[model samples]
Target: MGGKVVFKEYDPDQLTFLPYKLEELVPQGHPVRIVSKVVDQVDVKPINRKYKGGGASSFHPRLMLKLLIYGYLTNTYSSRKLEEQAQQNVHFMWLLGMKKPDHNTINRFRSEKLSGVLKQFFSQIVQLLVAEGIVSLKEAVFTDGTKIESAANRYTFVWGKSIKHNKEKIKSQLDELWKYAQTLAGEERLDTSPTTFTEVNAERVKQTIASINAALAEQEDVDPKVKQKLKYAQKHWTENLKKYDQQEKLLGERNSYSKTDPDATFMRMKEDHMLNGQLKPAYNLQISTQEQFILNYSLHQTSTDYQTLPSHIDGYEALYDTLPKAVVADAGYGSDENYCILEQKGIEAYIKYNIFDKEQKEGIKDFSNDSLHYNQQENYLTCPMGQRMQHIGDGQRITTSGYVQIVSRYQAANCHNCPMRGVCHRSAGNRVVEINHSLRKHKQAAKERLNTDQGIKYRKRRPADVEPVFAQLKHNHGFRRFLLKGMSKTEVEIGLLSIAHNLRKWKA
Candidate 1:
């Protein structure tokens, strides 16, 4: 015989209604409950002042902020999804006190009202975390950067190199056209001053066009070729010249930027499922984390991690009124300029340079190359074939950051008949190498620090402190691509994500 079975009864049309309280629906120690408590403690007076007194009633800023934070915590980034959840999800309904806001209202609040004020909100939450002892400002920070793909169209990328190349071609054609016009007029009609083609901007191109028209105005019998060239220049070159000018203005120091989102630069993104190196519109997101909690974050257009360190440190200082005692980062953030900046700021740098790992291998270390053996007192380098490479000369190198680096050039005595010539260097003549003394000194100092006990501890804890935050953000939250367009809006989106991450940490 089968065991006695019991089934629970359900009636959709039952008239009995129990007294339901939203607070009782959520249990204590729930993430949503913790989010509610934390949002209640945040000071929203600055956000409140953005709204004027006379208008139709809108959702309270505090309520909207709480809704947005909770939405992100639950991995609901889209406004439409959040709107749907607000009407259906019990936790969201409880957080909003059963007040359902439409998708447009949520998006408007995020983009328009909360655009400039997210920094304050993020700081307040961090300060609260500090007060709760979840974060330590004196602890060492683990810094890293990742490219977050922008919402801009990837095909509309404008590269600085392409612009320069095309501009030169156009300038050459225009110069030839000018010479042709001069030959037709039998005199130097346009200004033939000694100016480089690089100086030929849209205004100068327009002036040249006007000069050709004025020169051709008086002549009744004009060459058909010259007239045809003039018409072609006016039709084709004017718009391109103007467009290049605008693009140059947009690309001040960046290599490339997207047209739809001008502040987002084109960077090589990690490949998709097809395994191709796809260049997409992205922003470099630099974050400093401790114990897997994001202490600070800054957005940059520069693709490299090294260039983002100084400004990132500055932003941290601006937020916390002080800097971390020590910063731990991988080799990507290590550069001569970065070391100099960290030394000036009096922060301990446990960073690694490009060749840090390569020098650790046995084969590379046993090569006995000239770069490895340098006699400071004798000012000479010993080649792999036991030849003395003498220091030939000294020179000055100006870095991109305007710091002058002193470089010493070393040339092998003779490599023409050396036994190890093919292995050491494949050049027919003596090999020449330049070493920057300033950079070498900084690298030696960094190496010494990296070998110390405290440095080892920081190194061991770095991956634990920072990498999981990115994993949680990208993998757990499914926040791979940005939903917003401009830099400011993207910053707000990141700010919300950071807040949600911290709150989730706090709850855990």
Candidate 2:
């Protein structure tokens, strides 16, 4: 033994007679201290009002809220883990005042009492942060969307496209089967009532099955082939039709949804480790951030960020009673409708259009025939080959949101004998282009704004402001998948996470 080690103290059974204070155990400026202080400041009257004075005495809403928020902050999202921490962890014991609420109580409080009030709680914490001078509502906000996996099973997916295709096939088969039945009866014995296939649903399928059964029952001497066909329709077609209808209902306005968690849409998640476009049940979590702090967040069933922008800003307005002075987002959010909305609301839009990035390349501009000079007075464009592209008739283009965009058509005078035909027009006919003047104007205005110093500053700060919060939530806190099901419960859980994030930022 090299220089016999001297132990300062060792005691397994020696116990102190003095009482220990829980508050004295936690150090100053710790994150748990911040959580306790923030929870103490939040007004829980709304949460308190939800309780009816009938059941056994329950844990105080304030105490439960603090424990849940602290648990989320520490990456202890599971109710069982939280219960264990309450009994074992000193920090949790100190936060709970040595009171250990079982996992059932913890879960019930989170799933039931905390369901609708989470938005209020989130808004209150944001107000606190605003009051503390940590963030400002008037400042520009960077908005982005990420897909978080839902608690729903990955295999129980319902695709809208598949439902539509199968429904069409089933309709064709049913029509053929009905015709065969009528021919077999020789006098149109089967009912000729036309069924509306427009909105095929389980109820409608059930009615169709009942009608077919009644019709078959009325037949005194049915042919074997006709009977076999009718029975086949009842068994095979009925089940498929019902499935398609259920899928259609679940996928109202969305491309896909999960059977377990109907609110969660199946989207291509970035978590695919094999670099394949594997679809998983997930929710679009759109968050607006300022100065690395999450100012607001929303959950959408759609994966695209464009459609979520308007609703996201609406949510922000609902929370703070006013929209931000300016909104900054990437090209995915750039659309004519969004630009129009921002303009109507008098908010500066630092958004980029689809071609905003591509236009930055010098080579692209050289071959981009659309960038050629246009004579508005003559209503024509000059091609790169010094050819006059004559004005054709105007056409209307309908957007995904049903907004009609008017585009003036233009065609090159002649491309048959041009030396630069290979470089310019590869079409057999004259080069045709459609120009939406209004959308062009919006893009031009956006381009001008995006070139400004303030716009550049917003762009530079966007990734830093919003991306890190996601990293902290997903990587640091291990919130890759939601613990709760349904949109409402997921929203509540995210609200808790956001509150924890803001509290941590405040502590920092």
For all predicted structures, in order, the TM-scores are 0.91, 0.91
The number of residue pairs in model 1 that clash at the backbone is 0
Candidate 1 lDDT over residue span 319-394, tens digit each? 8898899999999988888998999998999998888767656324544342558889999987776788899999
Q: After superposing candidate 1 on the true structure, give the runs of residues whose Cα lies further than 4 Å from its correct spot.
A: 1-6, 188-198, 213-226, 363-393, 398-404, 412-422, 426-430
Q: Which runs in model 2 stand beyond 4 Å of their true positions? A: 1-4, 187-190, 194-226, 367-369, 386-391
Q: Please, what are the lDDT tens digits per residue for candidate 2 over residues 281-317?
A: 9999999999888999999898888988888999999
Residue 384, model 1: lDDT of 74
* Among all candidates shown, the one with the greatest lDDT: 1
Candidate 1 residue 64 Cα shift, in angstroms, is: 1.2
Tell me the lDDT of model 1 at 239.
88
